[model samples]
Target: MLKIIIAEAELEPMPRSLRSLPVMKKKYGRKDVVLLDSNYHHTSMQTLPDAYRRGRPDIVHVCLLNALESPLNKDGGLEVYVHTRNDKVIYIDPSWKVPKSYNRFVGLMEQLFSTRRITAGDTELLRMVNKTLPDLITEVSSGMPVKVMHYEGAPYEPDPDEVLVIGGFPHGDFVSDLPFSRFSIHGEELVAWAVLNHVVYGAHGT
Candidate 1:
């Protein structure tokens, strides 16, 4: 049986989906998955010297945004870095540069933003306001005082399975922890939502 330990930056509480991995494995037949939690603070590092004192991990999966931003050196240990690309796909790379496909996605976003026919204020409103604006011109034509405002902005279509991970301390430090793992890291929210749906509906299914 392969022993796998997942270590993540202790930002927020462990996600429920990730917390349930051990149960899922036991119910199925994979008795090798283990979930571990760790923060990037100094206190967390103090616990590390004794956490894995007995033996090193077969696979040390680091679930962080930019692991290579500050390359890690784990003597003789196999380390993997995973991150979610701007397009929401999990990318496992040993270096800092994003893949060619991610670059293409960024290019597409840039083109879309450049061609957008709206001002910054309107764009911000489009995301903030949820209701359609009232027709002020009709009221003005009816001899009633009315104000007309043109909010030109494209509609926001967020991915359905998109999960926003917000983290903040009592002071002001904050971070958004994303899922980026080789074992399961791909697709947009559709993939994650599908996996959650499966876990919910097909828990008994092999």
Candidate 2:
């Protein structure tokens, strides 16, 4: 029988669709599948030791949204098949070209200007930004402001909608109405644009 262990941080916060993995697995075959939510304990990795002793799973998959980029290490535990989604982490690699789904205006700004001096206003750019705003708001308010900084830069402001965006004045122009936003070349195109640009145009009721 194939046994799969799926580990993630918080099941409630994740979308119900994603949380239904165990139910989906039952449809395929008969196996011992465990979906573990880390929030039940103080430390997620701590649960692994006990879980391992109970039964060694055939395949272990960590499903946290940003597990790959997490500071925690998965090196010392039980030796078994381990797989993680690479999309969670964002790192710049010269060999890979930036995806084209990103806003052209925002992309140009990042390439031409430093992260500290970037902004966006195009229709598509706004749409992408709006999509990621709510998540950013929850993250920032949760005391993980550094995550917000990871996308943009230091110091951010959450708009009335609770969407966190870059907060600064552009080009040393104290009087200029233009707001300073930053964008990094990482993650999904839409999410990357929202974080780096410091603006969420479409996010409403968030």
Off by over 4 Å in 1: 1-66, 73-89, 96-105, 108-206
**What are the per-residue Cα lDDT tens digits for candidate 1 across 123-159?**
3211111111122112112442221101121222222
Kindly list the per-residue Cα lDDT of model 2 for residues 20-109, writing each as its tens digit. 556534542432322333323223334343332221111111111122222221221111111112111111111222233323422332
Best by TM-score: 2
> Where does candidate 2 stray beyond 4 Å?
1-31, 41-44, 47-149, 152-206
lDDT of 2 at 199: 30
lDDT value for candidate 1?
0.23
Q: What lDDT would candidate 2 get against the real structure?
A: 0.25
Candidate 1 lDDT trough over 10 residues, lowest sum: 124-133
